[model samples]
Target: MNRQPEPRQAIALKYDGKQAPTLTAKGDDELAEAILKLAREYEVPIYENAELVKVLARMELGDSIPQELYRTLAQIIAFAWQLKGKFPEGFDPDAGPVERDITPPK
Candidate 1:
């Protein structure tokens, strides 16, 4: 007996420092490949976390991620920003939490 491999999943997020991280794009299989390819072509850093992807994929396009996912997604965005040498003001990699609270007021 043979088991088929799981299809690859890809998700894209957008954060403008003024809003919650939003689900920009998500797909499986071939579409995932296309999204990943574009990321490579543009030198975008790719973060792979199957659990995170599974959670984020549940959100609709253009929807900001839920509050529960803020801390997890913050790490991803922080790393991406660090890679581009644009660390947020007062951010301390050694700190337990992000120095700045980017979450919008309720």
Candidate 2:
């Protein structure tokens, strides 16, 4: 029987107003490179500022895409599609649960 490939989710890499637009990549460096290559092929300006890029590059799957960056990218992509944006649906970047200590009080 033939099976359908799992849907790949896109992570938006938002930035501050002073920075450029970007997209988040999986942890694998090569995978990230490939994603960046595609973005470049489309003539999209991928921001490469040191300080900002450094922080974004380190974002892991479990971490919530920071609010500032989230808003920035959301707006850009929203506009890029002329407000008929196609954000990765059902991809809740902040859906993870919070952790807490359960040690007994002294």
Q: Top model by TM-score, which number?
A: 1
Candidate 2 lDDT, 1-106, residue by residue in tens: 9997533322335434343444445433556577667877876555444445556656764454555665445544545543333334554436664343422234
Collision pairs in model 1: none
| Residue 85, model 1, lDDT | 82
lDDT of 1 by residue, 1-104 (tens): 89998779999988899788888999999999999999999988999998889888888999999998887787788789879888778766666753567564
Model 2: worst 10 consecutive residues (lDDT sum): 97-106
* lDDT score at residue 3, model 1, on the 0-100 scale: 96
The local lDDT score (0 to 100) that residue 71 gets in candidate 1 is 75
Go through the candidates in order and give the C-alpha RMSD of each one to the true structure. Answer: 3.2, 16.6
lDDT, each prediction: 0.86, 0.50
